[model samples]
Target: MTEFDRRKFPPPEDEAMLPWYRGIFDCGFISLHPFFVIEGLDPRLNEHGTLVLEGKDRPAGADFIKWMDQLSAEHSKGKELHGRSVDHMAKRFGQMIGWGEMCERLGLEDHCELDAALRTHIKGLRDDLTDPEAADRMVRHCAANRIFLPVEGDIPPLFEAKLAAMFRRAGFTEIIAGDEFGDDECIVPVIGLDNEKPWITRDDFPTYGHLRLMAPDHSMLAWVHWDSFYTAIFATKERAASLDLDTTFEGFWCAEETKTFWLTQRPLPLVQPR
Candidate 1:
């Protein structure tokens, strides 16, 4: 195990009052995915959910780097990584590969396109993990989309029903259930394409499903989920206004370049079932 400075990633001072921070701490370990994916850190998530530092003697780390290096060399020579092609790697890792690598391997133009592709691929993987047709899908999906799926079991049906009722009360009806992939602890829902139809029930939805509310025109209005501690709401400005979220919770608009919505407080109390 590579030693990390706990002081550098100190627990939030207000964690007791903030549900989101509390929920993260409850997981028992902080993931270094963002550090690796965004900042090019040496750590990567292995199949066992352990962090492996690239080029280090932390046995797993060394093996992972060696494998990746071999794959890269083979790729340059127009060969597959081991027997698996780049396409196979993409389908297996989902969004874990950096945007540049994913685009290069998948022949995509940009990150936006890569995001769309991963969402579809991950959905299929989650829907049928045991299907013999794709034996490695589960492993690949987990490696790529860790923390997005529930580790123990599905979110409670009764809680989901209450969440649905809350959304309906807030005037959102075209809700679909599914997981969203992103860096933040909260799941982020993307707007469904025009050709896609919403699933009618949780059973019809994929595993680790969260509630995604859509506007009448199929634009995403909000992505909502409960982390067994508090509800996380990511909603458009207009939708957040409808819910009086700005007045009720501490939140901020996402980065101007990436999205046009507010990530309302880590743990929202407004919709918690009494």
Candidate 2:
């Protein structure tokens, strides 16, 4: 059997953000896509169920639910029950079971008459799910919080090498390249700002900084980032040598920490010859 490599397959167009490079002098800032979770990151953004949903292999949600109910009934008959049965039941449901079903399954207490309280709690959660005002409030609440940038995807080590070349062009000569942070391998540099305002804190120069290079035609290429910020901006302009420049419409979502980037190695139109 052939091995499955998710990186080999192109992701859905909705999440597409490919990047390419010509030379160190010609690089751009990575931008944020609208589909990016501005509110918060979805932790399970890239995962799947063990069972394939096709033909005889298809798993039915109702059948799984009924199976759990049967187990509950069996336990009630004074039969010896496994202490960790609920763990197994939860694992079986995985992604197929809906929210309400989950609540019901967990609410099955052995001796406590807490059914009414559980129902009330579930009702409140469900109401929030449908309430437009509540939805707005949630967004507002997230906005009010002072921390964290949601990571869209990881930037592969190969791509990191390309970024290093761009950083060299931007006069970041002193670099500390290591894998100290485990899977979060990074290449940090000591870039002297002098009179230029620092985008990242001096203490954070080892982990975060921006690199902006200008092309012969006046086109601008920039890798923008700051300490304590979630989003890193990679921006490119048609002409950086000229006073007036046109901005490229495309944006990318790259993370330096994760092992595999969701959108990896797809060719970008910007890398093609004019």
Cα deviation of 223 in candidate 2 (Å)?
7.3
Q: Would you estimate the TM-scores of all the predictions?
A: 0.25, 0.20
Task: Give the residue spans of candidate 1 off by over 4 A.
Answer: 1-55, 60-166, 178-204, 208-219, 223-238, 254-274
Candidate 1 CA-lDDT value: 0.31
Each model's lDDT comes to 0.31, 0.28
lDDT of 1 at 259: 22
Candidate 2 lDDT over 83-138, as tens digits, reads 32322322222122211222233342220112122222223223422334433432
User: Which runs of model 2 end up more than 4 angstroms from their true locations?
Assistant: 1-152, 174-187, 190-270
Which window of 10 residues has the lowest lDDT sum in candidate 1? 27-36
Number of the top candidate by lDDT? Answer: 1
Best by TM-score: 1
